[model samples]
Target: MRVALELVKEGRAEACVSAGNTGALMGLAKLLLKPLEGIERPALVTVLPHQHKGKTVVLDLGANVDCDSTMLVQFAVMGAVLAEEVVGDQKSPGGVAQYRGRRNQRPRQYS
Candidate 1:
């Protein structure tokens, strides 16, 4: 992770993609890349096979086992940002579009 981020930061690489341990990736990515300005937590996203049309992207897949609504919202934001970044447009699904941030309202009290 450090090496990948270093490459990007040093102008050796334009972008980076890694697939490994989720917890490890999150820890290392946070350490190297830091969170986006408005993003509270970085999300790990994947496109799954859908029965219908296009695939669905789910973020933060078990990254933080313990739950927080705000964090979930941030995941959606990050995931959408990722999609748009990849396709080079943040308009609509015709290419790639701004995603609806799927965040919950607040923290929940559990007993």
Candidate 2:
């Protein structure tokens, strides 16, 4: 995991994908790559196809399971930017961003 992250950091690779332990990957990434400035914790985000249409972005799947409001907002902003850039073109309409914390908790959504 460290080598994979190092490749990206050194510009040898664009990104790293892992099918190993989530905790291990996140731990190594945080230690090796470090979080961006002002980011309390780095999040793991995935893009999934929505049931109806378009794509849905889910974050912190295993990293930072208990995030604060500020962290949630940060994840939302990052997810929105990723969805817009990777899932759609600039002309596409922006979609909503939502954050659900813990099981059984109500979801907080934004446009």
Writing each residue's lDDT as its tens digit, candidate 1 over 7-62 gives 87677997668766667767776777767787766666666666875455666655
User: What is the Cα root-mean-square deviation between model 1 and the actual structure?
Assistant: 7.2
* Candidate 1 ranges beyond 4 A from true positions: 14-21, 48-55, 88-111
Leading candidate by lDDT: 2
TM-score result, candidate 1 = 0.60
Candidate 2 TM-score versus the reference: 0.67
Clashes of each: 1, 0
The 10-residue segment of model 1 with minimum total lDDT is 92-101
- Give the per-residue lDDT of model 2 (tens digit) for 1-111: 888999988889978899888888887877888565667667887778889877777766767766677887777666666777777734434333464557667555659
lDDT of each: 0.62, 0.72
